[model samples]
Every structure is written in C-alpha cells, then in structure tokens.
Target: MTRAFIFPGQGSQAVGMGQELAKSHSVAREVFQEVDDALGQNLSRLMFEGPIEELTLTENAQPALMAASLAVVRVLEKDGNMDFAKTARFVAGHSLGEYSALTAAGALDLADAARLLKARGLAMQEAVPVGIGAMAALLGLDIGPVEELVAEAQAKSVDGGICVVANDNADGQVVLSGHKEAVEAAIEVAKEKGVKKAMLLPVSAPFHCPLMQPAADVMAEKLTEVVIAPPRVPLVANVTASEVSDPDSIRRLLVEQVTGRVRWRECVLYMGEQGVTELVELGTGKILTGMVRRINREMTGSAVQGSQDIEAFLASL
Candidate 1:
C-alpha cells in the first residue's frame, strides 16, 4: 500500500508524551538528547514529566512536540529499517509539525529543526501581546461559510481589528485568528449563523493569521541561517496543499506559513488524490490521524506515538 508520513502540530502535546518510548528504545533517547543538546535545555524531561502549564507554553511546546515525533521516527528507522524515501509516497505536517516532517525526510538536520522551532515559537509568541489577539474554533461550518463570517466580523471591527481563517482542519472544523475583539466577533457571528459550536481557543497568541506577520518576518531571517536540502520524499506543504521539493520553495513557504492559513483538509485530500492509501502520523497524539479519517475515510490512518504503537506499525510493515 502507498503511504505518507504525517506529523501533528501544537495542542497535541501533553505531559509524559514520549517517556515510554525513550525508556524502551535507546534510539528514541538519542533523538530526545540531540534535541535537548541543540536547545541547551532538558526538553525531554519537560516532555516526560511536565508542569502542564510550562510544557504548554508555545516556545516549549513546539520543539517538544517535534522531539517526540522524531523519537518515533528514529525508532521506526532503526528497528524496522523503514527508509522514508522508498517506503513512503510523501511527507506532510500541520503547522510546526512541518519542521518535524522536514527533519524526518532529511531536508533539515535534526539539530537545525529543533533550533528553528524554538526560534519560531518564541517569535510567534512575541508577535502579539497576550490578550490582544485570540483564536476561536468554529465547528459544523465549512470554509465557505467561515470565510463569509470572517468578512462579516471584519466589517464589524470598528477599531480595525482583523479576523481571518487560520486552520481549515476538516469538513466541519475551522479556526479563526486575529485581534481578540475580531475573533470574538467571529465567534458571535458563527453562533448567529447556527454553527454547531463556536468557542475561543486557549492559545497564547493569534496564530496563522495576519497578526503574525511580525513573527513571519522574524522567521524569514532565521530560515536564511539554516540549510534546507531536498527531502527524500516530497512534502505537501500546509500553506498550498501541494507537493514541494525544491529547497528554495520550501524555505519561502515555511516563512509564509507563519501568517497563512494551514490548509490541512486540502493537504489530506491532495495526498489521497495522489494515491496515498495510508497516513502514518508519527507524533504525540492521534489528532492528525483523526483528521485524516474526517478528510477521507477510505484512507487508512495510523498514529505511532509509543512503543506498542511502534511495534504494531513495524509488524504491519
């Protein structure tokens, strides 16, 4: 069966995420150690045992999630000899997980990916002051209605607030991000439009929207400092939902992704159209795998996050 390796983004992190994997596999420990050394912090400790508040911080959570995901990838490679280039049809990730995908596909060095995510997290958090911006998830609404809702919300912004679609996650799940007032307006509008559910997200900063342009600028500079090589497999980028292999294009898209909507639903649909029969999510949670089912039920979805999951996947292979 054709396969694609996928990774999860933020909100998938939790305390004790990769502890068991590290204990069971030396390879997994090595992956976490490399990320810790690269960042000069014991991030693995944070993942294995966390004061949830600290671990949930954007700066810590981004790289921490990547480390956990890479630990799984390393285990799969060393234990099963699964070379992504030959075994997988494509690689893709949501938001910060894109960095994890690049690292797994050999496009970016592990250390570089860790450092880049740290910088990205810090930049994103600092782009807008806390409480000034917000994000809201509007359930039971498709992109078309959400876009019109965003327009209506924007029109109601007397203080020039901005509200736009941030993540097009699945058929009925869309996230809006921007000025707090604007996002709040979007939530109200969504409710008025008979959305299934509309609630403000508990995120520190508005992500994947124009309010993050400052973060995008910082990433533009940080990205140039790192080296990006061609991945072993093509990456279906979150911004465009298309296959991209050119290193230059990858770099450009990474920068744009900071302020662009994460087209996750489209990305999954594109992969299905490309004949990817299975999506293997190598990360801390089954969030992406669940999204895959929502996007295309015909496509199988598997999430390998722990040792047992790893063994099961290898045996399947």
Candidate 2:
C-alpha cells in the first residue's frame, strides 16, 4: 500500500502534546531541545506544563504544533522504525503544518521551521485588527453553496470590503472570512439556506482570506530569510494540490497560503488518488486523522504523538 505522512495544523495544538514522547525517547526529547534552542526559549516547558491560555495564543500555537509534528517524526525515525525517506510516497500538511511536513521530509531544518512559524504566527495575528475581521464556520453547506453565500454577502459589501470562502475543508464544512459585518451577513444567508451550524470562529484574525494580505507580505519577506532544500519525498503544496520542490515556488506558496483558501479537502483527495491507503497524523491531536476519514472513508487514520501511540503504530507497521 502506498503510504503518505500528513501533519496537523493550528487547531490541533494542545498544551501537553508530545510530552509523553519526550519522556519516553531521548530522540523525541532532542527534537524539543532543538526547537527550544532555535527559538531561544523553553517552548517545551510551556508545552509540557502550560498555563493553558498562554499556549493557546497564536504565536505559541503555531510553533507548538510544528514541534509536536517534528517530535513524532523523530520518534518514527528513532523508535517507530519508519524512515519516511525510505518508504513514504509523499508528504503534505494542512496549513502551518506544511512547514512541519517540509521539515519531516528534510526540505527545511527544524530550527528554521520553528523560527519561521513564530514569525508567521506573529504576522498573522497582526494582520487584521481584532474585532474587525471575522471567520465563520458554515457547516452542512457544500463548498459551492458556501461560495454562493459568500457572493451574496459580497453583493452587499460595505466600505469596499467583502467576505469570501477561506477553507473548503470537508464535504459539508467550509469557513468564510472578511469584515465582521460581512461575515455576519453570510451567516444569516447560510441560515436562511438551512445550514446546520454557521457560527463565528474564535480566532484572533480572519485567516486564509484577502484580509490577511499584510500577513502574506510578511511571510514573503521572512520565507526568503531561510535556506530550504527540496524534500526527500514530494510535498503537496497548500496553494496547489500538486507536488512541488522548487525553493522559489515554495516561498511563493507560503505567501499565498496566508491569504488563500486552504483547499484541505482537495489536498487529501490528491493524496488518496496517489494511492495513499494509510494516513498517519504526526502531531498533538487527531484532527487531521479524523478529516482523512471524512475525505476517504476507506483510508485508515492514526496519530503517533505520544509514546504509547508511537509503540502502537510501530506494532501495526
């Protein structure tokens, strides 16, 4: 069976993720050490012993998720007996986790991954003023229907602003972003169309939308500050559901991803078409694992973040 390694993005982060792996394996501990040194702070401590709110901040959440993803990669390398470089067909990640997938496939160094994510997080948070931009989850609505709703909202835009669909996440789950009032209008439109649940997301900014153009510019500048190599395995980019390795293209996509749709459902579909029968999520939570099931019901989904989960996955392999 063809295997693909996937990584989780922002919402998958939890304060205590990867702690058990660190405690069980010296290699996993080293991953945390490297990230701590790279960022010049004890992110590990915050991860293992968090004062919840602090770990939930965008700045911390971004790197923390990457750290967990890379830590699981270390375990699979040093303990789980799966060398992705030797076996996996391809690697892909959802959002910020794209960097983690790049790190796992040896395209970017862990230090650069950690540092870049920090800059990305800070830039995204500062992109739109709080309470101005909003994101709303439109459940039970097909992507086309959500797009229709976004168009309806845009038809009534104020201040030359508009709302747009930001994430085509799953069969019936999509996210919309724009000015707060526009999002509110979209929510009402979705409700009128009998949407199951259209509610505002509690995010610091309206990510994956035009409103995040400032963040995209910031990522463009910061991405150039690092050195990246082509990954050992092909990486399905977020902006395009195709595999890419060119450093310049990678840089360009990183910027586009800031203000572009996540296209997560498409990314997963691409992996499945390439014969990825088993998808392993290497991060703090099983968010991607669950989505993999929704995307392809025949595919098996599992997380390998903790020491026990690592052992179990190794057993299955």
Candidate 3:
C-alpha cells in the first residue's frame, strides 16, 4: 500500500499534548527543548501545564502543535527506525500542520519551524481587530450552496466587508470567515438554504479569508528571510490541493495560505486518487483522519500521538 503521512492543526492541541512522548523518549524530549531554545521561551512548560487560555492563544497554539507533531516524528526516526523518505509516498498537513509536514519531510529545521509558526500566529492574531471578524461552520451544505449562501450574506452585510468560504473541510462541512456581521448573516442565510446546522466557531480571528490580507503581507516579509529547501516528499498544499516541491513556490503558497481557502477535502481526495491507501496522522488528535474518512472512507487511517501509539505504528511497519 502507498502510505501518506499527515499532520493535524490548531484545534487538535490540548493541555498535555506531547508530555507523555517527552517523558518516554529522549528524542522527543530533545525536540521540545530545541523548539524552546529556538523560540527563546519555555513553550513546553505552557503546553504541558496549561492554564488553557494561555496555551490556546494563537501564538502559543501554532508552535505548540508543530512541536508535538515534530516530537512524534523525531521519535519515529530515532526510536522506531522509520525512514519517511523510503516508506512514505507523500506528506500533508491541515492548515498550520503544513509546517509540521515540511519539518517531518526535512525541508525546515525544527528551530526555524518553531520560530516561523510563532510569527505566523502573532501575525494572524493581529491582522484584524477582535470582535470585528468571525468564523462559523455551515453543515449539511456543499461548496456550491455554501458559496451561494456567502454571496447572499455579503449582499446583506452591514459593513460590506467580504465574507467567504474559508475552509472546505469535507463533503458537507464548510466554514465561513470574514467580517463578524457577515458571518453571522451567513449563518442566518444558511438556515433558509436548508442547512442542517450553522454555528459560530470559537476562534480569536477570522482566518483564511480576505480579511487576513494584513497577515498575509506580514508572512510575505517574514518568510523571505527563511531558507526553504525542497522537501523529501511532496506536500499537498492547502491553497492548491496538489503536491508542491519547488521551494520558491512553496514559499509563495505559505503566504497565500493566510488569505486563501483551505481545500482540505480536495487535498484528501487527491491523495486517494494517487493511491494513498493508508494515511498516518502524526499529532495530538485524529481530526485530520476524520476528515480523510469523510473525503474517502476507502482509505485506511492511523494516528501516532505518544509512546504507545508510536510503538504500535513501528511494530506494524
């Protein structure tokens, strides 16, 4: 079977995400330390013993999730003796998880990835004023109908700020992001469009929409200073829903991702079409795996979060 390694993003983080792995594996511990040193802060402390609110901050959560995924990858390589270059056909991540996928594929240093994510989180958080932007999930509606809903919402929007589909997550789960009033208006419009459910998301900012242009501009400048080498495996970019290995193109896409739709469903479907029979998610949670199931149930999935999960994956291989 052709195997693809995937990584989770934002919402998957928890209070003690990578603590167990760090305790059980020296390699994992080093990964955490390396990230801490790179960021010049004991983010590991915040991750392991979170007050929840602090750890959930966009700046902290972004790097924390990357650290957790990279720790598992380091363990898989050092302890499990798994070589992704030889065993894996492709690598992909959801949203910020894309950085984790790149780090796993050896395109970015752990320290660099940590720093970049920290900057990314801060930029995203500062892009729009609080309460001026919002995001909501519109369930039981496909992309076409959701686009229509967004259009309707935009027309009736109070401030006329753009509202659009931010994440095409799965078959029927699409998330909208933009001006707060527009998003709320979309939710009301979705109900009349026969949507099963439409609810506001608990997010600090409206990400992956036109309103994120300010953040995208910030990334354009920040990413220029970082060295991006071609990854060992291809990454299915969130903005393109296709494999990209060219370093320069990858850099451009990372900037665009700030204000572009996350085509997660299409990314999963494309991998399935490429003969990825088994998808292994390395991170805190199985959210990506669940999305994979929704995109294509025929593709089998596995998750590696801690020592036990890593051991099981190694044994299976």
Error of 1 at 20 (Å): 0.7
Clashes counted in candidate 1 amount to: 0
Number of the top-ranking candidate, with lDDT as the measure: 1
Query: Residue-wise lDDT of candidate 1 within 175-201, one digit each (tens)?
Result: 999999989988998999999999999
Please state the error at residue 108 of candidate 1 in Å.
0.4
Q: What is the C-alpha RMSD of each candidate to the true structure, in Å?
A: 0.8, 1.2, 1.0
Candidate 3's residue-wise lDDT over 1-317, tens digit each?
A: 88999999899989998999989999989999999999999999999999889999999999999999999998999888898888798999989999999999988888989999999999999999999999999889999999987888888876777788999999999999988888888899999878999999999999999889989999899889888999999999999999999999999999999999999999989999999898999989998877777789899888989888988888888
Per-residue lDDT of candidate 2, residues 1-317 (tens digit): 67888898888867688888888889988999999999998999999999878898888889999998888888788776787776678888988989999999998999999999999999999999899999999889889878887888778766657688888888898988888999999899889999999999988899899988998888888888898898899888888988888878888888899998888888888888888898888888887887778778878877777777878877776
Candidate 1 structure, TM-score to reference:
0.98
**C-alpha TM-scores of all predictions:** 0.98, 0.97, 0.98
Ranking by lDDT: 1, 3, 2
Output the better candidate (2/3) by TM-score. 3
How many backbone clashes are present in model 2? 0
In candidate 2, stretches whose alpha carbon ends up further than 4 angstroms from where it belongs are: none
Q: How many residue pairs clash in each candidate?
A: 0, 0, 0
